[model samples]
Target: MAGNESETAQRLIKAFQQFRKTGRNEKKIAGFNPSEYRVLFLIQRANENNSEMKVSEISQKLRVTPPTVTQIINGLEKDGYIERTVNPEDRRAVRISLTEAGLKATEQARKTFNETILGLIDYLGEKDSEQLAELLFKVHDYFNQLDNQ
Candidate 1:
């Protein structure tokens, strides 16, 4: 049983590495990397809840440190994808929002990402894709539980 578990773990690790490599290559061809798209997605989601998002809020949602969030925001701001303003309620807090360009770029990125995933689903078939999603969710939940502990 222990040997079987070891083999399973090795296979999972290899699969993840290959998936990441493929994702990175695809993102490169698509113009925006996964991390950039994720930041854009998070900001867009936050805007649905409120007009602006705080840097700390983004950090929390992305599961990254404030500094990391700030770094990404800096790049996005430089690219004209996002704008930062002083929070009206808190003088020290900075609020972030997507610019018109940011929104457009995010929309394009989302469309491309969805198409790519749909292609993968077609390749995997409906049943296999469903099973993969369930397994992935179970893996995520297991790690989340470990983190809480």
Candidate 2:
């Protein structure tokens, strides 16, 4: 890249690093960390589709290993947020679904998260927020493609 390009890239990198740090310090939603919230939401979403999620399905969707998914599932289970059932058709497979508490927690977290995001959009104004979202998605896609290659 040219001199100007290099400087701009450096600034962008620094800005993103700052954002990551800020995110790390942000409060957990509804007493759940990001991963836990995601898992609960995934299970709830699957329930809405008239199905339950398997650990492998959650693992694949989260882009994490089975062990990591299992760890999260274990914690959620112990917390009474989720339940595991034997997949009748395939006795070897386990299906996961949210308990009432889990569903309630997930819904509250989702509501709060969306409200926060909507407030950000309001603060940024519609046009700027839209542009920022599009730009972020492009950045994500660029990295995703690079990783694939």
Candidate 3:
């Protein structure tokens, strides 16, 4: 079981490395690196859900540190992609939200992500792609369970 898990981990990492190659050629995802794009997407989602999230929330959700989130937020702010606003109810806490430009960038990133995944799905076929997705979810759930244990 351990050997199989190790092999799965290696293959998953290799797959992500290959997937990241798609980002290099994406001219639309300018100014933001892949990680930054991810942060933007998360912020967009959180906003849509009518609940704002702070840098600490982002760090926890993304499994990064508060300092790392702060750094990314700083860059995003400078790029006019996001704004840091103080939470009205909590003056000491601040939330991150996308500016108009940030929302546009997030939309472009979503398009890029969808296109890349669609290309992979076309190559994998519907049946195989579904199976792969299911397996990947199972693997993720398995790891989460282990982490909790």
Candidate 4:
């Protein structure tokens, strides 16, 4: 049983490593890398409900540190893609929102991401794609459980 488990583990490791090649040379998914686009998307989602995000809120949601979020925010702000404003209710708190350019970038990124994933789904077939998604979620859950433990 241990030998079989070792072989299975080796196969899983190789499969995970090999899967990195499917990223299209990793040239910025929709004009931004995964981290950047995800931050933009989060702000965009908040904007839809008339809410702006704080650094701490973003950090919590992204499961990263405040400094990391601030670094991304700085780059996005430098590019005029996002803005930080002083909160009216709390002078000490700053809130983040998407700028016009940020909105445009976010929309384009969304379109490209959907198209790519949809293309992958078409290639994978509906059933296999569905199964893959389920299995991936299980993998995610396993890691999450490990983290909690």
Q: RMSD to native for every prediction?
A: 2.4, 1.6, 4.4, 1.8
Candidate 1: how large is its RMSD? 2.4
lDDT tens string, model 1, 1-149? 99999999999899999988876554541466766788888899888788667778878887889898888889999999999888789889887889999999998888888897899899999999999999999999999999999
Question: Can you write out model 4's per-residue Cα lDDT over 1-149, one digit (the tens) per residue?
Answer: 99999999999999888887667546697679788888999999999999878889989999999999899999999999999899899999888899999999999999999998999999999999999999999999999999999
Model 4 global lDDT (CA atoms, 0 to 1) = 0.91
Predicted candidate 2 versus true structure: per-residue lDDT over 7-88, tens digit per residue: 9999999999999888854568879988988899999999999987988899999999999999999999999999999988
For all predicted structures, in order, the TM-scores are 0.84, 0.94, 0.76, 0.92
TM-score of 1: 0.84
Preferred candidate (lDDT higher): 1 or 2 = 2
| Model 2, runs deviating above 4 Å | 24-27
Between candidates 3 and 4, name the one with more favorable lDDT.
4
What is candidate 3's lDDT per residue for 8-119, written digit by digit as tens? 9999899889978866644445456766987898899999998898888889988999999889889989989999899789899887899999999888878877887899
At residue 70, candidate 2 shows an lDDT of 96
Q: What C-alpha lDDT values do all the predictions have?
A: 0.85, 0.91, 0.87, 0.91
TM-score computed on alpha carbons, candidate 2: 0.94
Tell me the spans in candidate 4 whose CA falls farther than 4 Å from its real position.
21-27
**Clashing residue pair totals per candidate (backbone < 3 A):** 0, 0, 0, 0
Give the C-alpha miss distance for residue 116 in model 1, angstroms.
0.9
